[model samples]
Target: MRRWLVLVSVAAALAGGCSQAQDASSIETTARDFFGAVSDEDGQRACALLSSDARESLETGGDSCDEEITKLRLEGGEAGRPEIWGEQARVRMGSDTVFLTRWASAWRITAAGCERRVGEPYDCEVEG
Candidate 1:
């Protein structure tokens, strides 16, 4: 019985790790798709990936999200490995850092075009 319990524990641990890896991969994919849309000048598609608050941030002063998002010209190179904690994740790219949050069953970009600031939270061009 003890041996069986040990085996079950090992299996559970492995499953948890695999689940985290899958979450990371999904976050990375979302990040890549967002950047790709931006690169392709598909503002509509890019806006679709953003969280509601983030999207709303772009729509100000009578400017729509699709119009304002492309105007900023956010740049992000190849996506690096993502770090995820709970429902939040951060993906670092060659030129930018993106922050995401799990919304329902999917991940959405809460902030993009972020830069590190000394003694302060990340400064993002697009943030919720």
Candidate 2:
């Protein structure tokens, strides 16, 4: 059920403009690095890979961004192909789906551990 939802949301996000890049390789690389950081339990590095908005979101409540991010228990695997549209991108791994947006010269994660909803947006564990 969740996989279906993520797929749908990814498809929906891709319906917008074409990817700004000639190919989505850069987006894939960014997603891979983000997940690798998480898997390695390098909270600071993971946080650095997020969009400012996502960083702010992670830092909400009483925890610092780095502390909060590590507490989420995120799991990731090798990334599959990426779907990018303009500044937005979706990358799927073996167990999770990540959403990213381009900011300045880099791609940053906007959401992770996202699951699709029947009539709403993807529900993400980490979202900006």
Q: What is the TM-score of each candidate against the true structure?
A: 0.95, 0.78
Give the alpha carbon lDDT tens digit for every residue of 1-128 in model 1: 99999999999999999989999999998999998899888989999999999999999999999998888868888889999989999999778999999999899999999999999999999999
Q: Cα RMSD for candidate 1?
A: 1.0
- Residue 103 in model 1: shift from native, Å? 1.2
Candidate 1 off by > 4 Å: none
Scored by lDDT, model 2 comes in at 0.83
Error of 2 at 99 (Å): 0.8
Query: Using alpha carbons, what is the TM-score of model 2?
Result: 0.78
Model 1, residue 61: displacement in angstroms? 0.8
Q: Which residue pairs in candidate 2 collide? A: none
Candidate 1 residue pairs in backbone clash: none
Candidates' C-alpha lDDT: 0.93, 0.83
Q: Give the per-residue Cα lDDT of candidate 1 at 35.
A: 89
